[model samples]
Structures are given as structure tokens and as C-alpha cells.
Target: MGLEFLDVFEQWANSYDESVGGQNREYKAVFAGYEQILEAVTERSMGHVMEFGVGTGNLTKKLLDKGLNVTGIEPSVPMRGIAEAKLGSKEIILDGDFLHFPDIINVNTIVSTYAFHHLTDKEKNEAIAKYGKLLSKGGRIVFADTMFESVEDYTNAIVKAREEGFHNLAKDLETEYYTTIPILRTILERSGFTVGFKRCNDFVWLMEGEKQ
Candidate 1:
């Protein structure tokens, strides 16, 4: 699954920013969530930030404008190339997934947008634990992505996707795993984080967990 997804992204890397879902009406909802997330992060005083899956550098460009130092982790070679082009040749973008991205230290914030669902549930927990360990004291993770309440909810979402003519998307959803708010909160709390969440809509959510 990982290699397959990677191949798909590699193929789409050059045109991702102009893809159907990237700038179409279908993306308005995601853009709205991105705006809210930018606002939320801007209100806080975050020092060093690590962003995983920095696809196409849309959000990374905004963070750079805020004068924040960001380290990006992306596995796709072509995608990383595009991101580096957007962020400039010097900005550091490590070529690995979150679990394997190296040399991270003293990071105050770790953020990912619409990325983690690519991971299995066990991998999600593992990534959360890694985030807890990598961050400096009082550091937090601000994750914005598609989240569901349960497997049933995920199933319903898949059904809706198919009904909306997103058959391929629905098919992909069958194999991908997404975490729920309750499960995510429990995992973070167990890992010594104080958790908070906001629902952006039926499918998208923002979760923050500050290390204690």
C-alpha cells in the first residue's frame, strides 16, 4: 500500500497544485480548514516547526511568510522537488516519512495536514509517541485531517464518497485507516499530552496535544 500510494503521488507531484481536488470547488472545504488552522497556529508562539507530508508547499509557503523556520518531511522525490522549488532550494526538506525522518531535535511544534490517514492505526499511534518524544518541553502537535468517530462512520463516509461520484476515492478509503477523536485523545493522554480538538466539519478536524 505504501509503495502504491508513493507511486501515485510521484506521478501527480508535478501537477498536484493544479489537480482537480487541489483548486476546484471540491477543495473549498479543505481550504477553509487550512485557513482556520493557519489562524490557530498564528495565534500561538511556536518556535521550530516540523511539518510532515509537506505536499506542494502551499501551507509551507504561508508558514515561511510568518518567518517561521520549518523542516519538512516528504517521501516522494518529485513532490519534494516541487516543495523545495516553492520554498527555495535552501529550506531543509528531509526525504522520509515521519517515522524515519531523521535528526529532529528541540522541535516546538510538529504539524501535518491531511497526511496521517495514509498510515495504519498502529502507525498513527507510533507517530504520536514519536512526536511526544521529539518535541521540546511544552511542545504540541497540531494535526488537521480527515477523522471519523468509528469504523461505521468511515464506512458511511465511503458510501457518501461513492454516491458523490468519487468511486476511486471511496475504493481508496476502504484500504486506508483514519483515527477518531476519542481514540486519538486517549492515545495522546496516555503518552503524556493534554489533548484538545475542534471539528471543522463532518469529515475534517483539528487536534492539538501539548506534552505535559
Candidate 2:
């Protein structure tokens, strides 16, 4: 998978919250799902929480307001700066891609949104293993992003898009790699996590896993 999206994200960072997609119903639903994920994390363990790819502190600010100690990792300076301005010293936003961040052990909960798609399936599985080790017992992982149950599901979406006259959109979807939700569940379970998931939209889903 290409990281060209990073350049787009860099350009979109400052205006992300105000972008046209930001005002769409899909984005609103995803944001609601993010809140639910954070609420669930707080219920599980209020100790230490880290958000991978915490762009502009959208959910991070909510975490802080609810009084959970939060840390965020964001590679984009522009996005991180906006988050920093909103969060102040209430939380720390680390600078680096999440996989390379060395001090992640013993956290109570890990959350990420719309970011893991940047990783290939192999890399995503590697991350699952790493997250398994980083979490404390009974800790949880909360993720919200584009996920499908299988390749067929992904393909069907594309076909449906083309049928619905979204040819240009279908063309874009054809190029990206998305994690299969069932495969992700199996990987997390192998890493000792019991998982659950909910669909947020046609191509987006929210997943939760509790370390067992």
C-alpha cells in the first residue's frame, strides 16, 4: 500500500474538522462511534490510555474532559499542533508513527481511528501482536476504521458502487487495502483478546477487544 495519503492528510490536517466530509453523516456516525469506544475504555480501565494517530485531538479532547489520562501519537506536525492547542498539557501527544513508538507497555487501553489502513495486512498483524504485549491484563483495544468481513465484502461494495453510478468513487476504493474484520478477530484472539465489532457504515467498522 502506498503512503501517498500522508501527503493528502498533511494538506487536509488544518481543515480536517471543517472539511466537507467532516460535515457528512458518515463522519458524524464515526465520531459517535469514537465516543462510544472511549466510553468503553473508561469503563474497562481509567488508568493509562493511548490513542494511535490522534489527528487534531477530536476524540482525545473528549477523553481529557472525562478525566482519563491520555497520550496520543501523531506523525503529522500540523495535525499534532492542532491537537496540542486543544489539549494543552492535559495529555501528551507523541511524535512518530505508532509501530516505532518504543515505550508502549502496560497501558490500560489503546485506541486508533481511521489510521491502521496505512499498514499492510502483515504489518497490521504484527501490530496486533505488539499491542497484545503492550496492554496490561484485562486491557482493551478500540479501533474505528474501514474494515470488511472478507474480500468478497470489499468487492461487493465496489460492484455496488459502480452499479449505483459512483464509478469514480469505485475506482478509488479498488486501490486500497482493508483489513478483514474476521481475520482481525482471529489475530486478536490468537494474541489472547476476545473481540467484538459493529458496523458504522458500508465500509467502516468499530472493533473492541479485551485482553483475556
TM-score for each predicted model, relative to the true structure: 0.88, 0.83
* RMSD in order of candidates: 2.4, 3.2
lDDT of 1 at 65: 79
lDDT of 2 by residue, 1-212 (tens): 22546675698687677642446342343344545554554454456788888888877877777788888888887888888888775248987675777486558888887788777777777888988888867888888778888889888877977787766447656765576987888889989999999776566677889988
Of the candidates shown, which would achieve the greatest lDDT relative to the real structure?
A: 1
RMSD of 2: 3.2
Q: lDDT per residue, candidate 1, 47-161, as tens digits? A: 8888888877766777777888788888888888888888886457887886788887779988887777888767778888888888766998888788887768888888887
Candidate 2 lDDT:
0.74
Candidate 1 residue-wise lDDT at 48: 84
